[model samples]
Target: MTDGVPTWEEIARDHGRFLYAVAYRLSGNDDEAQDLVQESLIRVRRGLERYEPGSLEGWLARIVTNVFLDEMRRRKRRPTDALPDDPERVLPAAPAADEVYVGLSDDIQAALSALPEEFRVPVVMCDVADQSYEQIAEALGVPVGTVRSRLHRGRKLLREMLSEHAA
Candidate 1:
């Protein structure tokens, strides 16, 4: 971190997992999360010169979110057809034998994915990314009150969905 600004390599090496976690929570899938991280890194490289020294993770989160929202908007404008689930298609490898299963986390993740984007983004930003309301509002270009409202509503929705599953 020279001059209080992280170099691109340093940022990637230090915050790679953090970036992936936030990306995964936002996108709800591994492939999209990987893409988001890659794109975010590219943007970081380009904008490194302009980056101010404060809340590096917050800046990265904002970049990841902007990339996600941009992709969402583009998809909405030009939707694509889903690929047919062909029997001949390759399947992902099963989890390793050493891995422990946690059912509740899966359920929570599914419920989160099911949320509407408006609610989901704030939820992930606050709960997963550990961003502040002001940071979230700045990243999302909304009022702080709106961020708080969406976070409350998003948590309520998640609780309801989880309760339904529990019952």
Candidate 2:
């Protein structure tokens, strides 16, 4: 196995930064991005014994992608009180000062944020998160049936929300 620690460490040192960019896009913050990258390395390690040198980068990318998606699922599966329900939840938890004036029209991000965990996770995984249905199902530990249903419902809600503006 070619110096076990070096192989994994080498992989991480070489590719981890690139993967971290993808994680940050998925996670929306640096702290969570680093955590996801580190966790992705762990996952890649477990599968290393079966490593095919030809697809090493693909393998690493899959691990990074899955790790970020898994974090989204865990956040969704948590209790409702993961954040306070209060409207005045304050900045940081509330939108940042710049977001106060210069971000999305507020309504769209607000609508997305307001969606239930079941709908939100699937929607983000499909649209914004860009994870495949199979990947999403594996990360969320659910059937593909569940993923498709949730995605359909989530899209319908977003469509309705957007239509309100059209009307």
Candidate 3:
């Protein structure tokens, strides 16, 4: 027990930035991401005592993801935001050759935000967060096959989105 907050609490506090990063990618909105992390903390506190030895970041990520999904299910619908017709208003000018990778990362993030939750969750866990397929399956309560399938499809979608931007 460090400072009376318990080991898990300390762990969560230490990894708060990582949690926020995962939440931001999943929710795609700063405020929604913040809310997800805040709400997940309650669940984390409850589950910490029983948490087995493994990746602490992965476990916290699972909790935050579940909380976000739960809230999404509760709402049953999300308000869609349409992009402006003006290209200038939507995207800035093209990047230089040296800055291509930087632009690619931004493009990928935008593409990721467009994916459905079914694909987004698995891809983020496997690709962005660097979790194994088995770990993602366990956290998502789905089979490893499902995780792989989702990841494959998600990557394909990302490639398509990126190519569209390139051309």
Using all chains and alpha carbons, the TM-scores for the candidates as numbered come to 0.88, 0.49, 0.76
Ranking by TM-score: 1, 3, 2
Structure candidate 1, residue pairs in collision: none
Instruction: Compute the lDDT of residue 38 as modeled in candidate 2.
Output: 85
lDDT of 3 by residue, 1-167 (tens): 63333575686679888888788788776657778988888788778667776777778778888887887776666333334467675554454564345657777778989999999999888776778888899988999999999999998998899899999
lDDT of 2: 0.67
Query: After aligning candidate 2 to the native by TM-score, how far in Å is the CA of 142 from where it should be?
Result: 0.5
TM-score preference between candidates 1 and 2, better one: 1
Each prediction's number of clashing residue pairs? 0, 0, 0
As for model 3, its CA RMSD to the true structure in angstroms is 6.5
Q: Candidate 2: which stretches are off by over 4 Å?
A: 1-105
Local accuracy by lDDT, each model? 0.88, 0.67, 0.79
- The best candidate in terms of lDDT: 1
